[model samples]
Target: MPDAHPHPEPSPAHPRPEPFLARTAPEALHDLRARLRATRWPDAPEDAGWSLGTDLAYLRELVTYWAEEFDWPAQEAALARLPRFRVPVGGLGIHYVHARAVAPTGPVLPLVLSHGWPDSFWRYSKVVPLLTDPGAHGADPADAFDVVVPDMPGYGYSDRPTGAPLDSIAVAGLWAELMDVLGYERFGAAGGDVGSHVSRYLALDHPDRVVAVHRTDAGVPRFFGDPAELAPEEHAWLEGGAAWGAAEGAYAAMHRTKPQTAAFGLTDSPAGLAAWIVEKLRSWSDCGGDIERSYTKDEILTNVTLYWLTETIGSSMRMYHANAAIAPAQLSRRVEVPSGFSIFPGDLVRPPRAWLHRVANAVRVTEPERGGHFAPFEEPELYARELRAFFRPYRAAAAS
Candidate 1:
C-alpha cells in the first residue's frame, strides 16, 4: 500500500477553504409559514387513505404543525452546534459536518458518511455524535470513529451541479478528495439510496483509500445467467424488488425523464414540495402505513422545511437524470474492498447474504429488526452500532 493521506490540502485542483454557516433569515421562515397557511389543497378520494398518495387529511395536519407549531429557529440553532464547514471540491463548495473522534487513546478511524434524497447531512446528524463518542453512548471506546458527513452536490447546502451532468461516480471522486482535504488517507464509506451508489463507487474506484465499505443497499442488482443459478430465496428477492419497482417506482421514471417539469411545481409551491417528498418518507419508512409510527410532526416537517428553505428540489431531481448516464464500467465494477451489509426488516429491499456477496467481498452482515429507508434517522443507536462493528477491524491511525 502507498501513502493514502499522500498530501496536505490545497488539493492540486482546488485551493482555499470556504467555511459554511447554516442560517435562515426571519423573512424566509415567515414566508414559509405564510405559504403553508395559504395552501389550496386538493380533495381526497371518498375512502382513500395513503392508497392514492400522501393522505390529504394528514397533509393538512402536517401543514398546520409546520406553520404554527414547528420551530425553525430552535432546529437551526441545534444544527449550528455541529462542526459544519465548506471547502472547494472539484471547483464547487461542499457543505459537510466533520465530527472528530472523542475517545481516549486507541485506534482512530476516519469514516465518511453519505446521505440519500429528500435529506442531506441532516440524515446523519444523530448518528455522528454517537459514532464519535461511543464511550459516552455506552459503547466501546475502541470503536469510535471520526465522522464526516457531506451534503451531496445539488442537495442540502452544497452547490448544485452546473454546465455538465454530475453523477454518483463524480460525487464519489469529490468525496475521495474531501477526505484528503481533511487530511485522512484511509477511510470507510457508508450510505443508502443514492449515497449507497456513491459508496459502491468509492470502494470500486478508490479501493486504496477506502479501507472498507458499508451500505444499506447493493445498488440495482444485475443478473445475466439463468435464473437457476440463484437460490430460491435469491431469485425471489430479485423478482420481488423488480415487482416492487414496477408498482412503486414511477417517481423515479419521472425524475429520470421529466424532472425539469416536476421542478416547476415543487420549487414554487410549498404544498407540492411537501407532497412530493412526504409521500416517499411515509411509504418507504417501516411505520406500518402510519407515517407517525416512523416520524413525529417535527421530524418530518424539519426535513421538508430544509428542502423548502434551500430551494434545492430541482437540483435534487436532476441527480436522477445525471445517474441515468452512468458508464457501464462504473456500473459493473466490482467492489474489491472489504464490505459489510446491515439488512433492516422494514427496508424496501433486503437482499439475502448470497446476493450481497455477488456484488462485493461482504465480510460481515446482520439483520436488525427495526428501521426503514432512513436508518440513521429512524434508529440512530442501531445504525451507529452497525457502523462501529463493521469498521472495528480496520481502525488505526490515519493513513500516511
Candidate 2:
C-alpha cells in the first residue's frame, strides 16, 4: 500500500482536502479496555443461544478477545493507509475516501458511493480498490471508476449533526454539493441500507447530474399506490417484509422512537456496542448463522471500534427518527433516473420486478448466489463486478 499523503493539492479550480489519519488517543483506548473488562455480567438461559437476543456466551468470548487481544493500533494503521480526506461540505468537514482510477483504458467516470448506518465508510472500504483499479484485480480496466465513499454526517470520522439530524434527502443534497466541490460535473450514485435511500434521493433530486443509480435493496416498502395494481411477486414481497418486521424490526423501531435511551449503554459499554452490532452482522449476512463466516474478528472489530472511538452511535441512530419525519408526498415520489438493483440473497427484503419498476426507471436487476446485506464487505469482488457491469453503459454519458 502506498504511504498516506494528501493527493491533489489545493488549486484555483478545486479546494484542497485535509488528509485524515485514523488515530485514537492512548487514554481513550485504555479507557475502552477498562470498560470492556469491567462490564457487569448478564444472565441468560443455557439454551437461549440467539433465540432470545444476542447470545451471552458468544458476547462474553468476543468481549474477552476485545479486552485482551484485539489490536486497535494495527487496525488503525491499516485504515490510515487508505486515501482519506476531510473537506468542507455545507459548513461541515466531511470525511471521504477519494481514489482516482488506475491506468484507465477508457473514460474514468466519477462515482460516489454512500454507506448506511451501523457501519460507515468502512462498509465500502474493501471494494474501493477493486472498483478503482479493476485491471489489477483481473477485470477490464475500462470499467475502472474514480471512486468516492463519504461517511454520512454523524458516522465514522465525519462531524456529527449538531441540531436536527439529517434525513436521507438532506444528506443527498450535501452529497451533490460534495461532488460539485470535487469538480465532478456528473457522476453515478450507489448505496445500500440508508445509503440506498440517499442514492434514490440523489437521482430524484439531481436527475441531470447523476447518469445512473444502483442499489442493493429498495427502502422499506411504503405501499403508496393502489393494492389492486400490485403483482403476485410484489404482494408476496410485502407479506415477507411484514413478516421480517414482526420478527426482526424491533431494532429499527427503537431507532425510530427511543434511540437516546439505547445510546447510553451502547456508548458506555464496548461489549454492549459489539453485541448490538455483531448480532445484526450474524443475522443479516449469508453467514449461515456464523458471523465469522462472513467477516473475521478483526474485520468486525474494526467497524465496532470505529463506533466506540467516535461516539457517533447516538447520532447515527437519530437518522432513523429524522427519516421517519419525511413527508408522505416526498416518500411517494417516483425516480426517473436510470437505475439498477443487485439484490443479494441474504439481504433484508427484496423488492420484486413489479415493485422496482413502479418506483424507478428500472434497467437492470440481478440476484447474486451469495452475500447479504453488507455485500461490499462480505463479497467485495462480486459487488465490484455488479457495479462495473451496471454502470458500464452510463460511462460514455458521464464522459460527455
Candidate 3:
C-alpha cells in the first residue's frame, strides 16, 4: 500500500519537536490558590438555580474545593504521562501529544484529534490510548492509529495568538503544515464542537491531504441550503436550533463581541474564569443540570487552571471573533472528503441525517445512547468505537 496523496519532496529534514512536560510553577499554583481563597461571593436569586448563569452555591462549593483540595502536581503528572512535545509550526511554538501505535498487521493511519473551546488537548486524553492501543482496551488491534493531539493556539501549552487572529479555515491550513512536519502526507481528522468545525475545514481546505474525517457532531452551517424548502423534520431541527440559540446562544455572542471585557475578570480572578468556563461544561454536558454527574472537581479545575496559568482566556475568546469573520461562502463550502458523524444523545444540536448529508459526504452516522458535547471526554469508549468503524472502510485507500 502506498500513500494516496502526492508526497512532498523529502525536503530538508525537519527538526525534532522538543519534548514538553506540563508543570505549573509552584509559585503559580500558590497564587491560584490565593485567588480562589480570596474570591468574592456573588449573589443570585435564591431559587434561580442555574437559570441565570453559573449557580452561586455551586460556584462557591467548586471554588472552595479548588482552593483547598485540588492537587495541581498530581494532575500535571497525569498529563505528563502522554508523549507531549512543542515544535515551531505556523510561526508559533505549538504543543501536542504524539503517540504512535504498533498495530497487529494492517497499515496504521495517522490521526489528528482536535479539541474545542473550554478544553485543550485534555479532552482527547482519554481517547488517545483507545485509538493508539485499541487491543489493550479489548478492541481490535487492527484499528490502531498514530495519534496526534495539538493544543490549539492559546488554549493550553500552545503559544497564544494575541498578535493576530485565526479562524477555523486558517487553522486547517496550519494543521496541514503540522501534519507535513510530522511526516504524515495524509491523515484522518476528528473533533467535537470547535474541533469539529476545524476538522470540517481541514477536509474542505485539504481534501487530498485528509483521508477521512470523523466528528461527534455535524458541523452543519447555520444557514444550510434554504429555509423556504426543507423537509418537515429538517424544518423542526432548524427551528429547535434557532430556539436554542435565542435561549442559550448569548454566550457565543459575548465571545464574538466583548471577549476583552469578560477576559479582564476571567484573567484576573481564578473564580471568574471557573464560573465562565464551568457554566458551559455543565449546561452543555449530559449531566442534566448537575455538573458533578459528568465531571469531577479536579477535572473541572484542571481545565480552568490551564487557562488561568497561561493567561490565555483573552486569546481563546478572540477565536470567536476570528471565526465570525469567515466569509459565508467559505462557511458553506461542501466537505468533499469522506465524512463520519457520531450523534450523541445529549449533544448540543442533533441535526437530522438529512441536514448532515446537506453539509458533508457523510458515509457513516451513529447516535450513541450516551454522552454530550464533550463526547470524547464523556464517553471515550464510544467515541473510539465511532472512529474505528468510520475509518475502517477507508483503510485500503488510506494505507495505499
Candidate 3 regions exceeding 4 Å error are 1-12
Per-residue CA lDDT of candidate 3, range 49-166, in tens? 8989999888999899988999988988998999999988888888999887855457788889999998999899888899988999999988888888998887899998857678
Ranking by TM-score: 2, 3, 1
Give Cα-based local distance difference scores for all models: 0.85, 0.91, 0.85
TM-score of each: 0.94, 0.96, 0.95
Where is the poorest 10-residue window by lDDT in model 3? 3-12
Better of 2 and 3 by lDDT: 2
User: Which wins on TM-score, candidate 1 or candidate 3?
Assistant: 3
Candidate 2 residue-wise lDDT, 124-194, digit = tens: 98999999999999999999898889999999999998998999999999999888877787899999999
* Model 2 spans > 4 angstroms off: 1-15
lDDT of predicted model 1: 0.85
Candidate 1 pairs with clashing backbones: 5-185
Clashing residue pairs in candidate 2 are none
